[model samples]
Target chain A: MNINILYAALAPIVAILLGLLYIGIGRKIIARLQRRYGPPFYQQYIDTIKLLAKKTVSSHGVFFSLGPIMGLAGSMVTLLFIPFGSAAPLLSFHGDIILVMYLVVIAPLGMALGVGEGSNPNGSIGMARGLTLMLAYEVPFVLALFSVVLYTHTTSIAQIVQSQAGEWSLLKFHGFNWLTFALPISAIVADICLQGMLGEKPFDQVIAPHEIASGPMVEYGGKYLGMMVINHALHIYIETALFVDIFLGGGPVWFFIPATFSVFILSLIINGVLPRFRIGQALKFYWGVPLILAVIGIIYTMVVIK
Target chain B: MKQKTEQKKSLNQGGKNMTEEKSIDFFEYFIGPQHPGITGNFGVILNAVGDEIIKAQANPGYLHRAFEKLMEQRMYLQNVPLVCRICVPEPDVNEALYSMAIETLTGIEVPERAKYIRTIVLEMARLAAYLFYFGGTAATLGLYTLPNWSFGDRDYILDLFEELTGARIYHIYMQPGGVRRDLPKDFTKKLYSLLQTLKKRIKEYDGIFFDAALFKKRTKGVGVINKDMAIEYSVTGPNLRASGIAYDIRKDTPYLAYPDINFNVITENEGDFYSRVMVRRREFEEDIKILEQLIDKLPSGEVWNRYPMPLNWKVEKGDVYVKVESTKGEYGYYVVSDGSEKPRRIHVRGPSMTHGIMLLEKLLKGQRIADISPIMFSLDICPPDIDR
Candidate 1:
């Protein structure tokens, strides 16, 4: 059986559908937390369809149209690199985790480029904040990844998952996970950074609906928004899947739904109960407590934990 | 750092750039007739050099309905409904002040029991408005949960209002001499319970919103108004109080039953955004305390004065001004009668006319663009107040 050909065609469609479903469910969950009768679980699909059905607007230029497509493509390619539990990476390589980290950026860069072309100052402000926040959170997140990679001695996510088969990474040795517990600080930092990475509340300055008019998405309408929405959905899945894989052991493809949901709910609850940080405050916080935690976790892993 | 120096050089270029800011590095963003952070049909034209706002022009009149001029055409009693629409968050202050001014003009003394009832409704209205202000200010800092919770909590207050006045938002219950009706049966008992629920919820809110790390970080040192500036701008209500003045219309110039009701004048020194918000939070407790006093000592008697409020009600040729401590600040009304059915003039001085426009323009200059909403919300600017 030729797995490459099979996955190339099927994976993106399946991933996209699953991504949309997750987003739909996520909205319902957050809505319930606020004690409102939320929109239907399939609301994202309906919203996307509605957006697509609307008449197109005059584009700022060729770049504006290219932005969404490029963003979607960047995410799709990143999705292919992330292994779905037991399944091999669609394009596996020795240091694909690093590649995944850098590739994840392409989507936002695409959005930034599109926003730049639109010439909205608010969008530029929002993009600047987003990029600044990205710098803030990425450090701790990368440090957490480094802790795991150094401990496991493998940069490939597939190899890391395979190594965890005898015992899930969270409960590797007699219900005591070295990476999570021995240096609990790293895991805690990762959890906090994940909130920012997913663009939830408290860290949702970029999509600030009131402040800057949904920031970069202000001018987008019809198919442009639809493209961004689908891209957003895929972005959610990729990030959450990455978190689950690194910490919770992505497990078999069968456990993917439940595992991904647990992480989603955790992120959702954190998002629901808190107020937002100004971009400056968010930067200061990321560099303050979380950065210290990541540093301590890395030292512990290097000196003793591993 | 580089951009600042470059912008400085460009600013020095000063020829065509001075004539048109559009040609310069600066750009403008219209934050509202429909912005989420905006209060009613208002907007702010923010000119920015990078993320910092250089100038902010307060845009009002989008929600204007000329209530002052409208009052001139309507009968004395008829204008009561129109004045309440001036500030939507706490309409009772307008109602109370309008009624007081009219009472002074007509030389009609309100019944003692009606005064007590009016006092209770006013306190409840204050609580309702504070709840709204808290929720709204939190929303500006990106706390959606607080609004969801606070708005839900406010409905409990509204439910109480509906039970007493038969209307939720625009009660239109207060007339020239007194309120439209007596308290509903068991209304006092229900209010007692609602206060307890609110007290508990306020504590929970403290944990989730007020005490949250991000909120403190976002608000602290952000929109500081000095005592001198506060007085200069006539920034009344909690905003002025936040700048260290313990002045309150309820305490300073008592009306209705407030002269008898003892309460603390909540004040703060720093007058920063957080101080303004905390002042409102403390005032929430004070409002509840005042309501409790009104409930405990409520007189059981007639709730209206002995004047038939005919549609064509007339008053003598006299003018009087009355001010009430509203949720936003000192809401005032001046009414003049020409011994006819209609009033000669009626003027409203809403606190937001000062806070939302002139003070906002001052506070916004040189501040980060993100702080505009917080500063506006913390000041408790009701755009309808300005627009009206």
Candidate 2:
């Protein structure tokens, strides 16, 4: 019982720390890819702590404060369901994969809504752009996610991981077939595109400083801006972790460090190389090419795996 | 959900116009000050009837810094650095125009080497400024990669400026009689190579952004202006060139070393946003060619004039209005000298005041909200010039 209590308490702390680590490492790798000296590994943590200690300032409405809180809550909620180190999740339940996906979206959605409630026209425009981007990237992401479930034959994330363990790992289970491999590759591309939509460099259209001067976050200042920084770090962390869990098997303790670093470096390389897609183009990609590929992957899985 | 639907319906229906008599509803829309379509810190309050803009009032001075008023208080020499701030992007033109005005007033002839160097600097500045214009125009059409590429390349040119002028954005090197320093060893050779590399890369830009079908559709016939209206409104640079005007200050009134350099004035007869973009596109080639020619013909001579010391120097009591073909348009400075350390009066005539404000307002009228941004970009008007 005491062990269970400790697990409950430490689970959030460990998961949150991992989330923070993911952001720190991801930033460093992206910086390196862009030929820059990225921030130190603890940069995200320091930023978060700094934000929490500062005073919050709001321009238009109380919803601005509520937005970052909701983002934090979404991260915390996702952290609860995702299993760590073969341990049982803090709040595991049936159909939690869908909940995890929905939670991934909640942070940006809340931030967009809160920014739209502001009086600034630029802020509203930025929010509108962000929403358009959300619409563009989300559908392909959902389809890609469902393909993983179809292959594993379960919606429970832990069971999916368990299915990938050892000799029965999808790579080995499918004899490392090139035809089967296309599913994850397509999913990975979709994830990278989605990450761009999530507001990193190159595809940072919503908050393009030269064009709109930080866009939706333009009106936010002081501690409210600080919370935004923390929220962004958490969002990146969760997204990176989701990629790791989906494509990469939840491997042993020794593999975590290298796997984390490798996945992070891949994301950074992608971010550094590409330029942003306009909202319209992004919509076309998500609804058009990626959707077709995702359907193909799902149909292939249904026919072959069963 | 039901209540939200009802609220949305009421808002769209104007709260009760359908069930009763037709109310006089003159739709007034505030188009900017912070709208995505507006270029800088400025707004347009428009009263429209359907798709046509009936009444338009420009609420400029959003980025006003009172630069003309500020210049009146500074010394004639002190005004050099300050003038560069007037148009932040292509600052070399400001420096050149001001210096030429001072030279005219003082009756000082610049050294031949300094003249060539100034010409080179001016061309490079124009290229840099046009690169920025191309980037903005591409972005407005939702073609995003070109901006990333252009901005990255422009920084390389800024490095050259830092080496020559000891300042990146505003160079105070161009003074009354000549330049501050001579050319670095092999400067022309290096410039030639960079131009070669740029020529190769431009084709890539043409492939990705310029020739893309969507951009073609968006920009082709939008924001059209003929030569008559362009001349009447005092529009200049590529904006004027787009209206089929063959006039260029370099050709019409040859200043500095332009009489020695052979180059054609690029113009397009389309008189539309696409034509404006195309003019800049062709001008980018012309600027590179001019730079290459200037580099090859550079004569060996002293760069600076043996002018008197700064403290005792005074100009002859005279007036001169010198105009230069800047990246944007005709950048002119009119000076009145009373033979003191400072001038009695100085006036800057920047194209952006005509193009960004007056011309932009006129061109934007009756245009769709979508076309507004690309039209502003194609005009290539710098906001600081308008504000100054």
Candidate 3:
């Protein structure tokens, strides 16, 4: 068997496993914050198994069922470009970061299509909200990433990680020399954008439980919900992993996962306490404050950090 | 978009000017018998064009159990339990109203201490209902934490009710004359500590919910029931008070132990959603004050009146109307006796029947879908009250 083929096969399973761990840990942390006994750290795995084992699995047709599959595939494909530790990714290229960014959108677009055709108005409304939020948050996020690509003078995520090797990034565990230390404003804006990306509270109007009945997941049940849950876990892993790779710098296998989990924990704690932001307010904040921060960071990178 | 607008314009021209074929889209939004924003098994049908609500019809029959007709069938003494069911969140007000009406018809004098006890129970119910109101209103705006905290704190109040009346939601403690039982010997001390806990909790609520920037943006200027409209629609409770009206049955009519008790009749000038909820929030403080005064001036005597409400007790045929200041609003009860064991007629004037249907429908027009739940909850439109 080819070495690349072996990695390609193992990557998705590893991503799924990591996704489940992150979700389970995230829920436990949020539960502890709420001062209540939460589910066990392995609860997401059990829930996933239970959902897959559900007796009454319903679907609105083939395309509706295709949504989660597309999402899972997208998550897997996006992970191919992102390196974990010193090990080479399943697929890496000169400008894999741009490809990964575009690939990230395909999953949500796929889910939106499924949710639209499912004929649940709540889901459609949620899809609409999600897409609109996507437009708003993407501007600052792309700007922030574009600035990094320009400053690093490379489009490859692996090269970007390697550029920040040694004491160049803060996560190097030696001095305050990192992308965040130079352009903290961009990192801040990226964190806010990450909230929108994760579909968590304050920015969670897309899945507003009271407003639209969990939004796009309203019609999703049984196996589809299980798939959705898996997609959600993969989403958390991919996003936090992306954050870790881009800002915190990819590291040796020993230190990278913990660093990624720490960033996710910070986001989770913030999500647990804050009330959801109305879509309009969320849009305004993204376009207003974070946009400014991204612009400032881009300028600083161009003039100073370079 | 142009064609649709032109189509709308042509339709406005009595369909005579229709020259082009076009399709117009409208949404018929049915907001829950199962929705979280709904206080109970309640639903609203909103006729909307785009996100704007064109017509909102309040549906009230989902929770109907026919409490008035049920009350008419049962004897006056036996009707206590039935009246409490009329409003689920706070039942003591109904119990008090029923008792007061019977007291008036029979000319029974409640002991001073019994009056004080009834007042304490009413205040406790008010506090519980307000806490529920806070939870519902905040939850409508996507503040999930407040509901948990407020409801958790309200359990202490419910615990007090359970200790006093042996029930929580439907505390049928007040009888035709006074109360069903005496204090639990440590109720005042327990109540004082509970009040202190609640007082501390209110600051937390203010920080997280009431004073929240997002909450203010969501609620402010959303549902404004103007002074004249409030009066015309017969809106009562915190809703009416929030609309700049100072009318309260407890203060104006001076019922139960209210005439002797000291507390402010909380009011706000803005007839909007925020004002209405804030009025209830302030009233929660006033209820604590009233409870504190009731404890200080609690005379040691009979909790229940000496008058025996026999199973076969009969009175000279008469009708009486009695109203009380409940947490929701003025909860009024009317009774007519035909010199029989069972009352000939019983009618309830629930506050929600006015605020829920008439005012809710009227306010919802031209508002966004996001504003619907906030407006409904800020009105504190309990569906059971409307259904009953």
Q: Give me the candidate number with maximum lDDT.
A: 1
Clash pairs (backbone) in predicted model 3:
A169-A178, A170-A178, B237-B329
What ordering of candidates by DockQ runs from best to worst? 1, 3, 2
Q: What would the per-residue lDDT of candidate 1 be over residues A85-165, giving only the tens digit for each residue?
A: 667778887899999999999999998899878776667778888899999999988998888888778999887666555
Candidate 3 local Cα displacement, residue A112, angstroms: 1.2
Which prediction has the highest DockQ against the true structure?
A: 1
Q: How close is every model to the real structure, measured as TM-score?
A: 0.93, 0.78, 0.93
Q: Is candidate 1 or candidate 3 better by lDDT?
A: 1
- Model 2, A192-232: lDDT tens digits are 55565447544566775444446778767767777677676
Better of 2 and 3 by TM-score: 3
Instruction: Give the TM-score comparing model 2 with the true structure, all chains together.
Output: 0.78
Ranking by lDDT: 1, 3, 2
Q: Which stretches of candidate 1 lie over 4 Å from their true place?
A: A1-3, A167-183, B1-24, B306-309
| DockQ for all candidate structures vs. native | 0.49, 0.07, 0.34
After TM-score superposition, the amount by which residue B100's alpha carbon in candidate 1 deviates from its true location, in angstroms, is 1.3
